[model samples]
Target chain A: MTTPRRRSQQDLSVHKRQVENLQRRLLLKEMLSLGALGMLAGCDLQDGDAVDKVLWTMSRWNDRVQAKLFSRTRLAPTYEASRITRPFPFNAFYPEYDAPDIDGAAFRLQLSGKIDDKRAWTLADLRALPQSGQITRHICIEGWSAIGEWRGVAFRTFLERIGADMTARYVGFKCADKYYSSLDMETAMHPQTLLALDFGADPLPAEYGFPLKLRVPTKLGFKNPKHIAEIFVTNDYPGGYWEDQGYNWFSGV
Target chain B: MPVHPLPIRVFHWLNAFAMTCMATSGWAIYNASPLFGFTFPAWATLGGWLGGAVAWHFAAMWLLAGNGLFYLAYGLASGHFRRRFLPLSPSGIMTDLLAALKFRLPHEAGTYNAVQRLLYILVLLLGVLAVASGLAIWKPVQLWWLSAAFGDFATARYVHFLAMAGIVGFVAVHLILVVLVPRSLLPMLTGRHSSSHEVSS
Candidate 1:
């Protein structure tokens, strides 16, 4: 135990050092590029490939800063029923017509990783749990926003019911449409985060994540995984489809 | 003829580049989920992808904010605001506007006309508004007060968009004026002007 603790401490120090080094390097690169601008007239340093890496580093740094500043007590603004956007636009990797057609009767939510209960939960099991609803804005990263009413069980409640390890670093989801996403445990436990089973007053439609969707209003649209299949709690970083392609993993509004 | 100060020129050019990048990338980002009933073509924007546009927008946002803060500080410390942009009488602005409309305004080398001064000041204020509204939209939860001040996130976005339009209009007129008086570009470029080009103030 002592050896493991010492190694973990060393690893943490190394990680901290790496972050500091990256920040210092980014700053130095910015200054060097600015200086070079005057010496090399009309030479655009921003066009360089290294600039992309620097920007990504800066973006990651921004993510860390945002995460540190995030407040669990602060909630996303809720709206009145009248304020909800009608025909809340369908958005996904595929067209609305291509939405996954899952058999609700046969559907089972698989739970794994750091959980005392590894049983598959049926729709009835989820429906039997306590329910909550919120009329909140869905802010898309694409710059559009729509307000919708989401009714579901509080994610923390569901996690607790399933005996998920709340101390885990991440809670990841796999979806029926090959979509996957993970949330920081802090966000996962936020009061407003829900495992949504219904939209507005009706049961969730196929086009709107029939079986289940993770409604995380504080995050951008894509962070809310739809048609959730498997949920896992782990310390391992579970990168999402868009996240792997350079979207900030912690894409909070 | 008095040329623009070195710091002013540097700030001006840097601001120009930053705004161009910000606006173009902003358009691209907007195109992802367009407003005002139409979308800008992908070919017209700086970054092809929404992700790329977002990256560019953020990168340029830092440049614009940093340079603008520096410019504001220098303007304050050096009394540039008072000397060049203030003490404008309503009558003088009206006179300048009439003269400009009638195409009879004199091009003074060392000073700005009242109309020019007012427009410049307006554009500067709009730039600040753009940044503030942008911050509100960018981090509505983090900067809750700013978003609240604008009523909501939707309102803040509208304000940001309007500010961008205002700045774009100002730039359009500014470019036209520069083209009409091409000599004005020289002092801004090299921080110096030939004595022959100087007109009596």
Candidate 2:
């Protein structure tokens, strides 16, 4: 082959400089691609339904996968007392001040859906049930977690006592704060699932879903509803406040 | 032989699509509870809100994970990884680093240089980590052992973030390299007819 024309030293450096400049524009192109991405997402939202349907379908599939993964034998990790998040975070969509001030004496937990006992239970009645406690992590979908101590009656013990159908598919709560969530039967029957009435040696404070709250260490924090007004057991899927708004229904950890 | 096989091309493009959704939606998720001092800009993020972003993040997660596993299985079954990314060493990387710094490196089709090999290995491992760390975060309670291996639920978040950052950095460099060697893009797209990586120099 004939010899190719060789570049002068100056020409080579200048070519390198040109390459560097091209790389800068390439980064700019990547940013432009990001803009294209935003536009695609925007179209998916405005054009509607078709994409939403696919996403929701996949989400439902994931819920089933999560439900399958959940085990009644495995327990959420427990922490030492010293490791508890001091001044446990009061998290709710509503502000802390707006927390409902229910009359503890008059507050009664209402029961419904496949339960033989339709009568409500007072705070004392719940506390009188077999009480248990745990210092475990409460994971949030927002990507944060905190450890706290909660004491309450085992949900299974209470469920059995109230003659709830152990074979029921879902146990849902309607909270006084207008927040609602549901748990699969397997999770509801997990060893760590509690109907919490106390927080760290004190009676569960009003700010933290007092008189009654569901402490589910295995799932995200939102699945644990506070100031619970009604408990229902059923095979029908009872979607939650956030879950209805697009959060995963299973919300398992 | 095609420099990029059908399986490899499929994996590459699918990863491109999935990573786009994951990164953009992942940013939206990260913006929900920022680990750092600042957050990603809303305009740059994919999902409109936390819930929307989470749905996108999770939906794309399956794609990325499944695509990644497919790629891994293909690479192992085909012996493509050994042929393309082997013989990497610190000394080889150092030489390539010096040459790269001086703009003396050359691009050849169907072959990887030391630096490219190192980066590919790192990014592949990071991909595995991104998935593993995501699982650790997603199932800290159920996958308690996995979570504890990374220290805890919170630490898993950090690990997941680092994997994303590493992959992002790799993509920037990979894109820039593609720009520098535009010819390389065609094969990855259409599996152009060329000598495979097994060819002698």
* Best prediction by lDDT: 2
Q: Candidate 1 DockQ score?
A: 0.12
lDDT measured at residue A236 in model 1 versus the true structure, 0 to 100: 98
Docking class of 2: acceptable
Model 2 misplaced regions, further than 4 Å: A1-36, A43-48, B193-201
Clashes of each: 0, 1
The sequence of per-residue lDDT tens digits that candidate 2 reaches over residues B1-201 is 888889998899789989989998888889889999989988877768787788888899989988988899889889999999998989999998888888877666777889889989999999989988989999997888998889999999999999999999999888877766654666776677422222211
Q: Per-residue lDDT for B117 in model 2? A: 93
Model 2, residue pairs in steric clash: A253-B138
Candidate 2 C-alpha lDDT tens digits along A1-253: 2233354556656765674565556556656876766675652222357777777888899999998999898988898999999778889998899999999999989999999988999998887888989999988889878899999999999999999998989999999988888999999999899999999999989898977999999899999999999999999999999998788899888
For TM-score, the strongest prediction is 2
lDDT (CA) per prediction: 0.83, 0.86
Q: What is the TM-score of chain A in candidate 1?
A: 0.81
